[model samples]
Target: MNSKIPKSIDEYIKNFPNEVQQILQTIRSTIQKEVPEATETISYAMPTFVLNGTLVHFAAYAKHIGFYALPSGNIAFQKEISKYKFGKGSIQFPLNEPIPYGLIKKIVKFRVNENLEKTKKRIQKKKSKPNHE
Candidate 1:
């Protein structure tokens, strides 16, 4: 891609036009509101939200906004997300189409809870294991 890779979500959204920036910000804020503790960073040249692991990623394209919630998130919300164009783990919300912010919030919240549960399970598993000196 000829576009410059942004170092942060703010920088990434700043590169886009005003309308695109609004969409990107709304997506960012929705995710943030869902997981207030999640860290914001740039990964794969896109805006990435990280909790116990990667919660989600989003990028603005020429024609669409690419929202990635990983395979688990996609699988969990397959029925609702299937309406949009998608790949293995990502969905493309067209610029002209209405972006489903409510659905996105639900997905992000689900991911946050999922990640937290997984982290707790891992911790419990480790606690159960005997020390090997």
Candidate 2:
């Protein structure tokens, strides 16, 4: 495994195999296009995109590439992702299968909206809190 944490999504994609690298690159580009404000980094040993918090993460596995949108994402995509193997925040795309780039983009956009809502709520909560100091 590469010990270096990539500064950009392109460098992160270069760390993977040729084919998987291509898929990762496409996913990264789509996310960037959708969420221009998001910052890229390697978190939890996977390539993560963050806005107010983690928006999504993607990593290469032996037989599949995993995309993690966290908590509610799995539930939101459950019906569309039912055919594929997935966990709470992850969906595995088999190495031999075609990557659902559109779906990934849609998920990224949804995450962006989710993060914005969270940030708004957090700010509102902070404003409503009493300062006792």
Candidate 3:
């Protein structure tokens, strides 16, 4: 990993080798395909997509690609993610093995819907609130 933090997703991907760059690009495009409206930026030194909130994040590591789809997203696809190395909210797709782009797409789509629903609920709550003034 580079010492200076990346300012953008393209800069972050350029920091890696050709093989890793391709993998990162595919993952980025997969997330984009799932949530084309999501904005891309660098968050926590990784590539992150933000809509109403963060839709998903991914970074290339020495041995694996670290993916953060939020805890709920991981819980939602426990069976599929169980095959990878995972923690509370993050999953690692090993560089050696074939990356599951399809699963990544699904998880991203789930996260997009989750965030959108939460945003909608928050708006509804605000609209229903009684004005104090």
Best candidate (score: TM-score): 3
TM-score of each: 0.95, 0.89, 0.97
lDDT of 1 by residue, 5-101 (tens): 8788888888889999999999999898888889999999999999999999998889999999898889999999988999888999999999999
Lowest lDDT block of 10, candidate 2: 1-10
CA lDDT of every candidate: 0.91, 0.86, 0.92
Report the lDDT tens digits of candidate 2 across residue range 1-133.
Answer: 4888777667777877888888778888888899888898888878899999999999888799899999788787788889899988899989899898888988888888888999999999999999999
Q: Model 3 over residues 43-63: C-alpha lDDT tens digits?
A: 988899999998888989899
Candidate number achieving the greatest lDDT relative to the actual structure: 3
Please identify which of the two predictions, 2 or 3, would achieve the higher lDDT against the true structure.
Answer: 3
Residue-pair clashes per prediction, in order, are 0, 0, 0
- Candidate 2 local distance difference test against the native: 0.86
